[model samples]
Target: MPLEIAIAGGGVGGMAAAIALQNQGHNVTIFEQARAFGRIGADVNLTPNAVHALDGLGIGDRLRATAARPEFRISRTWDSGEETSRLPMSAAAEVKYGAPQLTIHRADLLAALESALLPDTLHFGARVAGVSQTEDGVTLTFADGSTGDYDLVIGADGIHSAIRHALYGADDPQFTGLVSYRGVFVRGEAPDLPNLDSFTKWWGPTSDLQIVTFPLNRGEEVFVFATTGQKDWTEEGWTLSGDIDELRDIYKDFHPEARALLDACTEVTRSALHVRAPMPRWSEGRVVLLGDAAHPMVPFMAQGACMASEDAVVLGCALEGVEAEGLPAALERFAESRIPRTTRVQEGSLANDWLKKGGNADWVYGYDAWGALKYEVV
Candidate 1:
C-alpha cells in the first residue's frame, strides 16, 4: 500500500524517517520549519544499535567510514584524572555488537541522511501551522497558509513539536536544572589534547559536573561535552554563545588535561537541559508523534539521537503490513511497540541512573528494527 506521508522536520530523525518510509514504497515528504536544510553545532555518537538501524537503510557503512571509531571509552575523575570506568570501543565494539561505535561530526551524519533523500522530497520554510485529521485522512497546514494532504502525518519536529502540541496540548518542556556546553575543535587546535583516540570522560564529584570528549571526522577533530548544575535556565532557543571562561570557572577544580581542552576551544555553545514527561497516548486519529516530539530526554545518556534513529526504522516495520485504511491501527501499534523502549531510554538517560554512555548496553545495542516486530490491522 503506497500511502502519502509527511514528516514535520528535516533533521536527523525526520530525515531518517523520511528515507525509511520512502524505502517502503510510500509517498513521503519532509516539511521543515527552517528556511533551508543544513546542520550546525554538536558532535554525535552513533553506537552499535543506531549503527545497525542506519545499516538497515544501506547508508550506515558509508557514513561510518567518515567517522572515527575510538579504541576505548575511558571514564576518569575530574580532579585527579584517575580512571573510573574503562570499556572497549571501535573495532572491539563492532566485534561484540556487529557494528562499530562511531563518533562523527553532526554534519557528516546529516549529509549521509540527506544524500539518500531525493532533492524534491523536502520542503523548506514550511512551519506546520496546524494539523487536521478526519476519519478519512490527515492534512497539515503550514504557516504560510498552504495546505498539504496525506494519508498519514508524523510529528518528527523535535521537542517543541507543533504537531505534538496540537495532539496533546501545550506541554512545555521542563528544564532539568542542568546546563551544558558543547564544542568541536580541530586536533591541531589543542596539540596537547588528551585521549584523541579514546572516548573519554572527566567525571566531577557530582554527576551534573562532567566533561566528555571523543574524536570525530576521522580523528581530525575532537568533540567536547561539558555540563554543570544550574538550578534554573529559562532562556529560549536550542543554542547560544557560550563563554569558555565561564566553562573554565565551572570546572576550575578539574584536572589540567580538561583545562587544556577548554583553553584550546575559542567558541562554545550552551543549552539548558529540558525533557518532557511521558505521554499517556502518542497518537490520535491518523496523526502520531515520534522521537523527541513524543519522549524528550536529557543528554546524560546521549541516546536522544539513537532513539530517534530507531523510531525512523521501526515506523517502516510497523507500516509495511498495513493498508491506508488501517493507518490508525498501524500508528497505535507503532506507539505501543515504541513507548516502552523509549520510556526506558527517557528514564535511563536522566543523570544516567541506569546506563552510562559508552557502557555495556547489549540489550540496547542489539535491537534489529527491521526484524523486531510486525503488525497488521484485523
Candidate 2:
C-alpha cells in the first residue's frame, strides 16, 4: 500500500526523506517555507556515513563528481600555528568505512537532492503553520491558512521547527554557547589563501573558532566556515550579514594562511548555535518528526544531514510490509531504530565542542552511516 505523506521543510533532510519515500512507491508532498531552495551556507563535510546514504539514493557518483575528496584533515593552534595532529581521511577512510568523506557546497548538494525529486512534488513558500492527527490520518495547516490531510505527516523542519513546537511543546532550544560565522570565497581570487583541498580546523582556548574550506560546483566556488562566540546570536535566516573585520580581529593570532583565509572571505553570515536534548518521542499518532525536528544536535560532528538521510531510508524500510494496524508499529520501530544511534551522534557532536578542535579526530571522522544502517536494520 502506498502512503500519502506530507513533509514539512524541503531542506537536505526533508528532500532526502521525500526522495526515499517516493522511491519506495509512496506519495510524498514536501512543503518548504522558503520561496526557493538555495541555502546560503558554506561547505558541508559529508562523511563516508553520509556518502553511503547518498549511494542508496543513486546520486553518490554525482555527488562525488561535484565534491572534493580531501586527502587529510588536520588541526592547528590559533596563536602558535602549530600542527597538533592530522587524520589522513582520504588515504585510510575508505578502507575503514567503505566510503570517502566529501566536502561540497550546500547549494550544489541541495540541488542534487532536489533534482532527484519528482516534478512539482516540492511546494516552496508553503510554511507549515500547524499539524494535527486523528485516528485515520494527519492534517497539515499552512501559514497561508490552507489545510490538507494525509496518511502521514513528517516534520523535517529545521531547528526552531514549527512542527516540533506544535508536537512536542514550546521549550526553547538550548544555546550551546557557540556562534558560527560562515562565508564563501573564490580560489583564484584569494591567491594568498591556504590550500583548502583538505578540511582543516584551528582550535583556541576559551572562545573557540574554526575555518573549513572546500570546492563546489566544479571548483568554481569555495565554501568557508568561521565559528566563534556570539553573545547576541539571533533567529535570523542564513543571509544575515556578518562582519569580516570582526572575524579577522578574532583570528588575528591564527596561522598566516588561516588569517588570509578569513581576510579573503567576502560573503559572511553569522548565527547562534543551538543544541537540543534527545526528544522523549519522535512520533505521535500519524504525525512524526524527522531530521532536526526530532534530533537537532551541535554541528561539531557534522552528522545532522547524515542522520536525516538515515532517517528517510529507515522510515521507508519500516513502512514496508505493514498493514493499517502496523502503521503505528512501523513508526514505533522507526523511532526505536533511530533514537539510540542519533543519540550517539548527538552526544558525540556535543563532546566535540569541548575537545580541542585542531586535534586529529579519526574516531569522529571514521564512521560508516551505510554500514550502521545495515546493522540497525538487520
Candidate 3:
C-alpha cells in the first residue's frame, strides 16, 4: 500500500527521498523551515556513488548538463607548488564506476532534485518542533503550534535535528577544532589562476589545514573550501559572513597559486566543523532519521552529502509496497543496510586520509545503492 509520509527539513536528502518515494507510488510531503530556497552553499562534489543514486532518481542528465566534469584531482604542497598526486577523473571515473563524477554548485544540485518532486509536495516555513509516534502513526508539531499526522516521519533536519532530539535525549556535537571558509567566484575572475581546470588541493603542514578549489557550473565558476585550526568558535550557524582578510592571513604562507584563488574571492562564509558519533540505531517506532541527523561527520572525505543521497534511495526501496503494520520493520531494514556503510564513512572522514597522495578510492566511490537493495527481500 502507498503510505502517507512526511519529511521534515526539505534539504538535498529530504527532497531526494521525496523523489524516490514518489517514484515508488507513495504520497509524500516535505516541510521546510526556510521560506524559500536560495542560491546558498558553495560547491558540492557528486562522486560516482552519489551520481548513480541520482541517476536512478531520473535527474542524471539534468545535473550533468550544468555540473563541471573535472578531468583530474590534483594535490600539491602548501608552499612549494610541487605536485604530489594526480588522480584521473571525468571519463576515467565513469568507465570505472558506471557513473560520471561531477562538481556542481550546491544550489544547482538542490534545484535538480526539486525539479523531480511533484507539485504541492513541499511546505515552507514549517519548522518541526516535536514528533511523537502512536501505535500506527506519527504526529509532528510545528513551531506555529500546528500539528499533522502521517504514517511515517523522516527526520532529514541535519545535525541539530529536532526529531532526533525528541526521540533520543540531547547529543551535543563535538567541535573538530577546525574552521572552514568557503566562497564561490566566476571562473573569469581568476583567469590567471593555475590548475583551475581540475579539482585541486594544497596541503598545509597538518591534516586539518588545507585549501581545496574546484570548478562548478560547467567550468564557469570556481569554489574554494579552506580549513584551518581554531581553538574556539561560538557561532551557532553554518553560513556566517567570513572575513576575507583574515582568511588570506591564515593561508599567507601558501603557494602563490593558492593565494591567487583566495584573492579572487569577493565574499566568503565561515563555519566551525563539528561531528557526532554514529547512533546505535536510526529509527525509533514510526519516526526515523536520515543524513546528518543519524550520522554527522567531518567533511574530510567529501562523502557527507553522498551518504545522505544513498540513504534516500535505500529507504525508498525498504518501504516500497509495505503495509502500515510492517513500517517499523521496513525502517529497521533500511537502517541495517545503511548503518555499517555510513559508519565506516563517518570514521574514515574523521581520519581525513582520503586520496591525500592518490590512494585507492574504489571502496568509497564504487558503491551502487540501487544494486545493494535490488536483491533484498522486503
TM-score of each: 0.94, 0.90, 0.97
**Per-residue lDDT over 1-378 for candidate 2, one digit per residue giving the tens place of the 0 to 100 score:** 888889999888888888887887888899998888555664678877777777788778778778878766666677677777566676478887667888877887888898899998999888999988788888899888999989988889988888888887897888877778888777776765554666666766544567656655555666677788656655756667888897888888777877877777775887777888987688887777889889998777778887888787777767766655557767877888788888888987887653344453444454444444356553
For model 1, residues 39-127, the per-residue Cα lDDT tens digits are 67668888788888998888886787789988887877778888767778788778888787888878788888888986699888889
Candidate 3 lDDT tens digits, 105-216: 8888988999999999998989999999889799999998999999999999999999999999898999999989999889999798777878888888888779998888
Q: For model 2, where is the 10-residue window of minimal lDDT?
A: 364-373
lDDT agreement with native, every candidate: 0.83, 0.76, 0.90
Worst 10 residues of 3 by lDDT: 352-361
Off by over 4 Å in 1: 353-359, 374-378
- Model 2 scores a C-alpha lDDT of 0.76
Question: Which ten contiguous residues of candidate 1 have the minimum total lDDT?
Answer: 351-360
- Total clashing pairs for each candidate: 0, 2, 0
- Which clashing pairs does model 2 show? 49-369, 75-358
On lDDT, the candidate that comes out on top is 3
